[model samples]
Target chain A: MTDAPDRPADAETGTDLPAGPADSDAETDPRTDGGLPAMDGAVPTRDPGAFSQLATALGRPLVVGTVLVTVVFLILPVLATFAASFAHEWAGVLPTFVRDGEFLTLVNWRQALGLTQTDLGAQRGLGGFWTVFGVPIPVTIGFSMLLALGGVVINLLVGVPIAYAVTRYDFYGRGWLNTFAVLPVVPGIILGVAFLKTYSDLPSAVGLMIGYSLLKAPYMVLAVQSSFESMDLRQLEESARSLGASWPRTFLTVVVPNAKTGIVAGAIVCWTLAAAEFNFSYIVYSSGPKPFSLFLFENISNNPFLQAAAAISVYFAIVVVVTALLQAVGQRGFALGGVR
Target chain B: MSTLDEGPLVARLRTGTEALLSPTTETDRERRRIAALALPFVALAVFGAVVPLVVMFRISVAEEYLTATAGVQFDAWVTLLASILAFVPGVGSAVDADPVYGEVIWNSLWFGAVTTVASVALGIVIAHALEKYDLPGEGLLVTLISFPISLPGIVAAFMMIVWFGKTGLLTNVFVWLGGEASLFPAVTSNEVKLTGRPSGTTIAVFGLFLGYLYSMVPRATFLLRGAYAEVNTDAEAAARALGATPWQTFRYVTLPQIRPGIVGAVILTFRTALAIFGTVLVLKALSVVTFRFDQILKVGYDLPTASALAGLFFFFTVGFTFLSLRFTSAEVTG
Candidate 1:
């Protein structure tokens, strides 16, 4: 929706209806039926042709203008963060270009990437290592992927059975269990506090895993369960049972294969959500074995703005790329459930 | 009616006779097998969700302080009740009148309500616009519009900072403009300066409104689009043919059809806004219950008090969810 200076004339096609008065007289087209008579009714009061044209001219740009502004608002942060990664003391509505007739500094990029140590405070290590299991890992992306994947695994293990049970049975507590599945909607920090207070004895990583899985389970359940609901379980299961397959065997072999797309969709969504999870991670994670979000949040204030922006952009890029992939996948099979 | 009454009873009697005849029947084994299949999920939920909530309630009621020494005593529940009642007209005052409770609760409600209304209103319009228009690159536009839903709250908070924080691009623009404005004193007032400071309550609330909108709009759009698709466009064409203005047609014909979507969006946005944590945290606005709860629990380490807040918050969630369920059920039945 950004206002491109080179906006094509055809861009206005979305808003400007063919039913405008000027085009109405040429009523050979099926879509312009109402336009001619409506213009005829209003012609005595004013020149309807000019008025409609003016309205069309005014309305289209106005809609486009609002859209452009919204787009800017939507993407300003990412753009600003990306710009700041290479900016040398950016302080304006937009980053300055051609500073002294040359490109601005890449000092922020280097500082952010841990290639060089800037004299940031001692507490703020200059893009230093994030430790996992007492071993320092230089790449935050790998660690992030691992934590997210761990959440995915945990959710699949927990969610698949829940989905199966709820979809496949008319159980006693089915209604209540279905209600309880939506426990993910409870804010992560609440669960964070709950888990921290309750499982004070357990390791932080375990707490994180449990918390994330609990939060992520609903989505996985919903995804797989919807797929199951759409399927004719009686036909599939009965057919399998008739073929001398045991219930569990039929379920594992037949049902699981049918809902494979849903499982994968759920896993991808769960992974992305876990990767983006910050509040719970912030509360649950101590110094060791940090998630990427915590990794960024910790360095936000202490590190240089550009350096911090670089780190944020890294995560932002990951989120956008993963989300785009998810969207592409969503277009094929399962709907991505909302998570905040 | 006779069959309905006697069928289950007859079956039970026959099953009893069968069970007596054969102690380990196939039906019994099959029932056990099905129950066993459902057990794992039930166990997981009980351990993960039910146990934690129970423990949370227990901790909330347990006394953080005794008369002389800290002990796992009772009376916090009484205090909690009193605090709740104190908000009532006739109830005079709370015994443990911590100002934080009043401020946090009030702020949570006020901010949550504002954000919900704003987000829902915007969502309706956006949803309508996206659907009603034959927009070019509509899919891409839809994707762009909905992309914020996938953004983590922390990232949204950071985006807020990037746009509006001190040293932010927008703030810098204001500062630079202010410098230029001084040269034209007749036009520019002293109040025109951008201080480049952290936002106050009003601005923070606005920022949160934006954040909530960012999160909720896509979801609302998704839901409403389905609702919109189901809407009878013939009715809209009829209204248009009858010379009703587009706005009038939308108000009269279209809105009623999408009321369920609107209600769903309202409930969802309200719930999310009330429970939102990261935005409030990054904005340094601890006025709301969720942030206050985190602060009290994690930072202050006042387990009893924090637990009370959490307990209250949990109740709020449950109550709203009940209301939401009621609405959905009503919509279904009626």
Candidate 2:
């Protein structure tokens, strides 16, 4: 910033410079633009199609060695688990896992689908009980579905009012409101637990719904703000007041449609997280109704049953599949789109 | 008819609430309001999550918290040796008693660190590859990679149990393909077999990594994809126009740009792995209590000691998370 080029310019385009330092202190100075040097633009090149050279550097001893060691040391067990889901009767050899297959049986998938457990301490789950009437799939998966649905439903209600306040009017604590909403969503079991303790002894199911909304509402509000931010306020109110429409009607017709995608995508993220949840479910529902993940936990603890495992797998598979389908249909571009 | 259009009442009511919004108020009033709103939520979170931990910590340090077997005593720390001696008779009883706590914590931390480091690195590579496979089953592959996220940890654990366990498909397939002698679980004699134990912290960590990675990779890929878009393509072209190696251009340009994304994803994954309970409990069945809470409680609950430990655990978790999130968010947002 000491350089003439980086120093403040006329209030024209905000950043109208060609983006370089003044030519004076080139040799001794490190930073050319802000803290980053402008010489970063220049790189001496070698061959055409030299993209392979980057790949070659990736193969350097440090990179290759670290990657291999990580895979062997860290990822191998995960790989083992993924394969074990298809297993049955192999537990003796694979003592670490609940089920080990002596011979491949579709039984894990079957029992997971709500068939009777040959072993102890397992139950039917949401994936298995799927139908039009909606039979309750027992255990972790079912509980998760309920939590996810509850999160979405509650957020839709919570988000609309907050969105309206930010969008239609200049509201109180608008800046800090934005921060307070988002500040909770990051993973921390301690803070969340602390929040719930004040409202304890009620149903944990209620806690799950409320907690998820509290965490997700900020993200939803942030997303909704984008649509609210980009709006032209004059046309919206002028037309409404002129045509004898109320403030609510004008918002419903003009505002909501434009912001619909952001809200939907935000809601999806909120609910998906609820469905794919863990820590709270484990801690909150210590004696309450177990969710799909918790039920899955019971399966592993009681000794693995292929049917039970498969049932749980199918439930989640269905969720992911549905999400992907929705994502595909919703928007084609914008990688950071509200789909979250 | 026009009289029904009275907006005064509604406007007044709305204004009533909005009046509390202040440009200038006593500092204490604002602080009090903030605390009031925050305190309730904070209290709720504690009762639900921290109470059990509080109970654990109190007993660890106190006279007694649990109303179960044994007297109102606070000598559980000393008796930790006695339990170890009973469980596994001691070559060196008092010194390394309750080694499960040490072993499990080590296993958890090492596994978490390695997996996070690995995933961030591989996710970048795989994401780059997937951008244009121009091949078949791309959708399925992407979905499969993300399977662990939506899928629960227990389910993943069970899956690993079946697939990598001694009689699992891979092992069975290996044996079926006539590699039994070289394959795992070879039964030379009735008494001599090669099946491995399915319950251990190692596999549990493995299960955790899968679940964490499946959730993390998509986000990381998204971040990197954005990072990749931000790359000055013209600079690369200029570099190619000169005599720079691709490695040189990437080292000098691409990697520096993507550093923030990589760090953020790594932090997210590490936190997720550390706090995981489902996989560890299910896989090991809580037989191996890793940290101080589980270990001390397994020893009789000395109220004051347990409370101190719980406070430490709570503080440690909060401090670690807050610091990491601060660093990662700053790195990215800045």
Candidate 3:
């Protein structure tokens, strides 16, 4: 709730470490910026006239405004959906709102979460209501979650061996493997669709795994590789090898701990993507239990008030919650590299 | 065939093979095995990206267009492959069927243009502001602002619809202002016409833009801000002291240095826009026949048109990607 002295701005409680002068020197050096000191440390001073001091104090608004705008862009629509769900009825023109004061109710939840959809005639002008995924929440969300989680687990398992191989020793295809792993995002779905089309006859879930793995595996490989890159592997291997420790014992006792942060980050990324997934899930399974995005898409109705269908707002809410939870976990673990 | 060449060469080759098979240490053995295993992953990447994209490009050229009959037709595919020079008119006819296709393109481009400029502008401003305005929550603000990275583009669209729709709270605020139909258009019913037009394409495009802005701005901010952060103040002060306006300083000094990031941002924005059918379609129920919206969704929803559109987009994407890479490399290393 803190506001800069003379400005109106939203409340903020940020956590990145402050920009320091030493970081500035590397840039502001003559070689980089023509010998000028980095102006990152420069502060804007107010005029010598009245309110000079007051103007200087309003720094929070200037800086926090950008964050607020971003939040307002992101969170407000979702909060509104939560509001729409509660209000018993919606009727409006422009700023029009629900006539009934009820702004919170489990009816939206009850209807949406239940496995069966009710055809409430005009009120629920939708197709048949038998749940597609065995639940109102849609089996797709569950499946996608499982898929992404599966992806995280699988990639971490696969990527670690891959990383260790590259870091500890040399191989013929090592450079090519590394390059393949870090290649930037191309149209991954084109590849996803190709694999899906070729393997459509198979159990779709397996097809999905293969399709998503095409993208996720590489991400994991790169993340793990970078972590390995910075690692002081000699310390771990030497420590174990010097102590008459077997290769397995040395890897277990030393190497694993050093790579924990990167692995955890990659896992978080994999899981979040799996849960939040769309395209690969879409192209792979068509309309079945695969993509969490289907649940999110249910609410984008011509009837805007029926936001349960276009639950993307809900998607954002879940994202915020997940992030908060991860932060809590990272803080608790004193995480060296928390998921970004 | 002769039993084989009998010479010292055979003996030398056998020794080499033996050396390769026999490792001196456990780690070396493990490393050899891993290298062997890694071949699959490389094969998978090649199979996944390189092969499919090549196939898609080839398929795009096949004139035997996939219709409702096949979703991938043969004649169109052949036509595409044969003429080599004929892809332009072929795709052009496909896209021009929609009246809004051009408008949608303009709108999408405009959307990309506006959002790109806005995000880039905001990114640079925030980067500079973070330095000048070292407020209490500054660090947190930067981190929070940069966090929309993981929020999917589609999710952002829904949030925006709820936030900006006629029944949305903001729209509700406008309603409170005496049912201002001009400022706030009707969102609830298809019965209600918007700004004299009911098509949700432009509205949908706006929604997509906002979503993309959220996702891309943070990326832009992160990359450009990092670039700016590395810049020395003395250089900025020098520019400022040399009679440069604040705008001029940013343009002359800051802009060129961060050009690579800006180019990356453009490629990123263009890439997403090219593939943005999902968000646009979901938001507007975008149609090809009516063709009034930024056709962003319509771009890919229709099979033949989308196939053609996708091919066109792939060309642009590859070209832009290559161009950006070339330019960025030239700038950085030059």
TM-score of structure candidate 1: 0.77
Which stretches of model 2 miss by more than 4 angstroms?
A1-144, A159-200, A214-254, A286-288, A328-340, B1-109, B131-144, B176-216, B285-334
Worst 10 residues of 1 chain B by lDDT: B188-197
Cα lDDT tens digits for candidate 3, B1-334: 3437657787777765565488676655665566554655656556555665665555444444343122344554343333333324456545323233344444555565677777766766665676545556765565465455565555655555555555555555655643445444544343221211244556554544565565666655654554555566787788666544454455556666666655655555555544554454445533321122124223553333434444544565567656676666422110
Predicted candidate 1 versus true structure: per-residue lDDT over A128-172, tens digit per residue: 566779865455556667777887887887788778777777757
Kindly list the per-residue Cα lDDT of model 1 for residues B64-105, writing each as its tens digit.
432222346556566656665565545536344544466678
Superposition error at A252 for model 2 (Å): 5.7
Q: State residue B332's C-alpha deviation in candidate 3, in Å.
A: 11
lDDT of 3 by residue, A199-314 (tens): 54577776666556666664566556657778778776887889898776777677877887667756665566566655555455654453665455554533344546324445
Best by lDDT: 1
> Which regions of candidate 1 are displaced past 4 Å?
A1-68, A96-106, A113-141, A168-173, A183-185, A332-340, B1-37, B63-72, B78-96, B173-200, B232-245, B327-334
The lDDT ranking, best first, is 1, 3, 2
Residue A303, model 3: lDDT of: 34
Give the Cα lDDT of each candidate. 0.65, 0.50, 0.52
